[model samples]
Target: MRKIPRWLARAPIPVFRLGIGGLLTKRLVMIEHRGRTSGLIREVVLETIKIDGDDVYVISGYGWSSQWLRNVKADPRVRMWSGWGRGVGALATILPRAEGLAVLDDYRTRHPGTVRALATGLEIEGFTVDGPLPEDITERMPLVRIRPRR
Candidate 1:
């Protein structure tokens, strides 16, 4: 039962890379942060929702333990890329946890179905699913928001 859905969910990466990859090219905002331990540039892609006044926000729904998150914590200075294309250097500001929650709320509203599917897929992938849950679910999850520093 779950295998079918899991396969179906996992099946889209290649297609996305093919069909949506071009659009996603610059869509994936890559943040380059220095490693806390090694002091090297570590880049990770976070999908951006561009906002007014040159602001872009990415909800780290997977939470704060990611390497990128750790790097940012060590050093806020970062270079961003919208896919392979280069982006201007911007400071990485960790949006306050409370504000981050709001951003996640908006994300859920804007992408209800995707949110649900991602929650399930991530759960199957053995990632923590404690931040936010689909309305039908029986748990809560934490979300983080990232905004380009001015």
Candidate 2:
């Protein structure tokens, strides 16, 4: 799979810090999480998969080892800034494997092109752009549910 350039991947962070990130919030979200080892605030910009009321769903395309995922697993508390809502208190929960797959299916059905691109980018085999995804897709792309703490 092709990896995003470090600089380019993190470029949106400054925009969020500058308080003009709302423009991208409809499809993206900025999460402020406490680093597991560092115990310091760390930010990451992720694509918004689906929003169901106070819950926001996102994908961990980079897998379980992703820094953001690991950090969130260690400390579910997070601060979010997005169009749906912005708050300093939120919780990150790794959706159940079956549920994650369901969410992935929903996302794929609604945004085929986006899902195709993600599959292609991840170099996932057996996923036809115009057809159903592989059964074990959750291994490559897990879903996380973020919601208000209160």
Candidate 3:
């Protein structure tokens, strides 16, 4: 619900690049979008999961409240930097809420560590925000599938 801090956004770029450069399976991408409110360019490093063919999916524990979600909504045409030196320009489509939930379920089943961390974030005392995909989001969550622009 809050805009990402400028410093936090800028700080992670190098680490992301380093990780992506070092790891083969770990594909970190830089998603570039136009901010819905400010109309300014924004970028975020996201972990991408490749679906069938060129399709890619991203799920946020914060759901549609995240700025990246809003930006994608505002402009589906965006640039994706895959790994350290690869790039893909794609059209991002918001999948049905049910599909998003399904993807999240798959993620949970595949990555127990992620599920546990998310669960802890949701249930722990200090981290009070609802970090898990809520029923409400299952009803209206934005699940995006990015496809290469032809």
Candidate 4:
């Protein structure tokens, strides 16, 4: 995918910080994590893949290279905000390969337009928005499930 301008990418952060992200909460979520090295708290707005009960799933199209993904791996603990929710404690689970593929499958089945647009942006070889998803998709674009801590 073409790189997004840094300014455009960071535009939503201020919205979240100002506490108005709920307007798009059904489609987006804001997650806060401790930096792996800096140990400072960082926030990012990510697209919501699915919301099943207390589990909220999202995919890192940038894959493991995404700084947030790397940091989350270092520490599974995180805080997230969605509709009518703010700073809700949660745990980040990197979905297994098979499960990631399954989630992508279901997501595509449910939202073809969104998946098609996302797949177009992803530009991963053998990973189509419609056709059978590649088995290695998880490694290329990791899917994560964030569940509120009980």
* Number of the top-ranking candidate, with lDDT as the measure: 4
Q: For residues 18-51, write the lDDT of model 3, one tens digit per residue.
A: 5453343344556778898898978776655446
Point to the candidate with the largest TM-score: 4
| Candidate 1 residue runs with Cα over 4 Å from true position | 1-22, 25-27, 124-150
| TM-score for each model | 0.64, 0.89, 0.71, 0.92
Record all residue pairs in model 2 with backbone atoms less than 3 Å apart, i.e. clashing. none
Cα error, candidate 4, residue 53 (Å): 0.9
* Tens-digit lDDT string for candidate 4 (1-150): 655566877778777766777776678888999999999998888898889987999999888789999999999999987765357899999999999988988888889888767667766566565577877889988999999897
Ordered by lDDT, highest first, the candidates read 4, 2, 3, 1
- Candidate 4 wrongly placed segments (more than 4 Å): none
Model 2, position 64, has a per-residue lDDT of 74
Instruction: Tell me the tens digit of each residue's lDDT in model 2 across 1-150.
Output: 667787977988777777777766568778999999999999998999999997899998778768999999899999887753344578999887789878887887888898778778877565444666677777776788999877
lDDT of 3 at 95: 74
Model 1 Cα shift for residue 67 (angstroms) = 0.9
For candidate 1, give the lDDT of residue 130: 44
In model 3, what are the clashing residue pairs, if there are any?
none
Clashes of each: 5, 0, 0, 0
Which residues of candidate 2, in runs, are more than 4 Å off? 84-87, 126-132
> How should the candidates be ordered by TM-score, best one leading?
4, 2, 3, 1
